[model samples]
Target chain A: MHLAVDISLRQGGFTLNASIDCWSSALGVFGPSGSGKSTLIRVIAGLAKPDSGYLELDGDVLFDSENRIWVPPHLRGIGVVFQDARLFPHWSTEKNLRAGMTLETTGMFSFEHIVKLLELQPLLKRSVNDLSGGEKQRVALGRALLAHPRLLLMDEPVSGLDAKLKEQILPFLARVHRELHLPCILVSHDLPDILRLTDRLVLVRDGMVCGQNTLEGLVTQRGAFDMMRRSGLMSFVSLEVDGEPVRAGVRPDEIMLANRPVEGLSARYRKPGVIVRLIDHGPTILCLIDTDEERLMADITPDAVRELGLKEGSPVWCFFKAGAVHSFD
Target chain B: MKSISPAEWTALLLSAKVAFGAVAAVTLPGVLLGWLLARKNFYGKVLVESLVYAPLVMPPVVTGYLLLVLCGRNGPVGGWLGRTFGWQLIFTWQGAALASAVMALPLMVRSVRLAVELVDRRLEEAASVLGYSPWRIFLNITLPLARSGIFAGLLLAFARSLGEFGATITFAGNIQGVTQTLPLAIYSALQMPGGEAAAARLSVLSLLLSLMALGFSEWLARRAKTGRSTHAPCR
Candidate 1:
């Protein structure tokens, strides 16, 4: 099912005036903190009400302030998994899982099925706190799924997880979208999450939709550069090679020394630029390179620096493959 | 030990009856007022809160005197009740129980109010989403979660009623085998010549009963706290 939301809410000095009319199989709300990412989802879920707005889910008008019609969150057929797991402490993992299910919506997604889907069988007897961060998030996902929500809203579902734990849970989340045939709006600030989970991205900035495009298309836009500047980073353009579409993402440590236009064997996306500055960082120096209105951070070892005779104002031909480009928010 | 005399037994039985009756009288209104103060934010919230706590802070005799004026036979409400329902409250066992209920109402309300405030609004929202009506939600979810606090309040109210003195004596008068609750009996025993042993026994009994009630209240609070999950389910 598709969801449509156009809501405006004011909190102190910040005003969130968000309007979205897109329909996607999966939509990702990608933004930095304080960008009203959570507020948008909360408004749609009825957790936080917008002062004046209208919400229609799957062609049903869930809320319209003008009409004074408001459908509460539970009746909206939407499920939300907050960043914090919010598992009931008093309940066992099984009981907490069961809490999301009832007789009216029975058998849509069974308790056993969710337990298996999230690999929750081992955790059934454990208290919510007894489980690790990854386990709690999995249980939270299972609980939301058992409720049989028409559409799911996940707010940074893995923000607290370490890299390894995040890797562990990402596949399960992907499977939920695939197997359940559920439309989802996933909110996060992490680029990897968007790349791994969603095709369509909605970028929010200062409580407004600054841009909306595919992950690939948005990264190519000027706003991407602006966002990168705020992030103290730069973009490495992806190129097409041998009829195979290749994308390149710049890592801060991958650049090597090249004084002249060295004939690279097969590296794609060759860009000629000058080293602008070098900041000493003990064994390595942070080399700032300027290429076509873009600044990239490259960490080169002192040995590589001495061998290449690299210095500020030195012209260099950076050879990197287009396959490394990662299109994420 | 030995069996108590009939006079002492009479006082013990009377106190038990008064405490029970006081609980019955105060529970419904106590709960209502507690919920009102806890959940609502209407005008005069502060004034109502102060008025409810007045008996707790004010001299009990003053509260008893107020009750006497309002619930006495010739008083406006008392006269109306007498005319319509043939109910008379002044200087009777029922009047003593009413006085005790007034003295205990604030304690009952404060505990229940605190519990009601702690009931998560998100859970209530979750209940609504689950197709439960507001009344059903209150009965099933809210009440169960707040039960420990309500029971603590009830026990406190009952204990307060058992030991109620100034209000009961002032409003109902200390009549032998009638409105003479434990405190009133103890007061009377202390005044009578050669009544030290009986007074000491009654004091010990009061102390034991209060200690037991206090212990139970602490247990209930601790149980409620331990039952709390670090991450309670979101609405």
Candidate 2:
């Protein structure tokens, strides 16, 4: 299913002109904060009115400013999972999920299945406040799924979670995309979430969509690499090496005392990078590697630096597994 | 000579009757107004809110005088009612009830309005997506969720009606068995020569009734908070 949206809005001095046309089952809108990501999602969900726009989902006109056709959120058939779970504090988890379904819902996912999938049975009777951040988000996802929306709009659903918690939620997101056969538009600033959940990426900058393409295509693009390099969201382009792929990523904490280049199947891409700066970061030493246009941060133990005789002007080969280099754009 | 007088008992019953009558008359409208003020954003909303709350902060005597001008016999509305339906309100128990209702209207509105404002609109939207109509949403979601505030408003209105003195006396007058409410009877007892003990008794009853209403309101509010479920509360 394809969803098309073209909208423009101006609030105070900030003007947002954004448009997205995607055919993928899972699309990611990647942007920094205040990049109009929420506003764009709101417009798509029919929660916020755009000054002028046309939104069509699967050839059905949801909003056309010219025709004055503005369907409210309920009629639009789009389920939204806000950053905060936004669960009803007055209803049970089961009821919250049930409330999303209509009497006419046929062939939709069952409430029981969702409860089991989200592991929400234990939380069904508990108050919303009693649930943890991760559990609340899981319930929120279930609530949206029970609605059987044509398109799911999730705004930074896992941005608040730590790395491990985010990883735990990622599989559920992938399951929704795969098992449900539903198209989704997820908005986030985290590259890892986009990498884990979506194949298509839409890069938004200054409230305007600057790029939209496949993750692989975006990864190879100069602008994408430049943005990540500047923003501290590191990306290393992976190319096919032998039958598998040679991948690379920055594990800033992994650089250690290496007198010589280590050889093994684990080192996916070993490139000689120049150490441009060295600084003390508490107990460890932070080595700044200048790899062409991108600067990589490596956290090396201070003892490793002294043993390796590494300084600002030394040449060291950065080594990491190909798996660490995420295929996401 | 020391026993509770029949007239005093009648006055006590009449106070309760007027209070209940006034509460019944204003409840649905009070809730509607409360919801409207809490949720709707329209031109002149502030003006409408100011008008609804005017009786709360305005002098009770002035409000009673306004009621006299509006609903008194031979006045515009009173004249129309009397002419059209032969329904007279001046110096009647119904008239006293109407005066008490006016005095308590803002209290009812203010409490319920606060409750309505606290309801989460997202849940209401979620209900709409589930095919519930706006009215159904209000009944199933908004009203139940704001039950505490609404109950508080109801108690405040009931208590205000029970104690209403100035407007009740001015609009309906103090006939012992008809319009002499608790506050009015207390006033009468205080004014009568050597009626100190009777006045004291009436004051104690009024205090007890007010305290009871307040206690019930607090209990209902606490119950609502504790009973709130984990699911979406508003819708």
**All models, DockQ values?**
0.18, 0.30
Residue lDDT tens for model 2, A135-166: 88998899888888888889999988876677
Q: Write the per-residue lDDT of candidate 1 for residues A266-324, one digit (tens) a residue.
A: 65556678898776656667677787655556777888888888899988777664444
Model 1 docking tier (incorrect/acceptable/medium/high) = incorrect
lDDT of 2 by residue, B76-114 (tens): 999999999999998888988898888888888888888
Interface RMSD of 2: 3.4
Residue A311 in model 1: lDDT: 90
Top of the candidates by DockQ: 2
Off by over 4 Å in 1: A228-329, B1-3, B24-36, B74-94, B115-148, B218-235
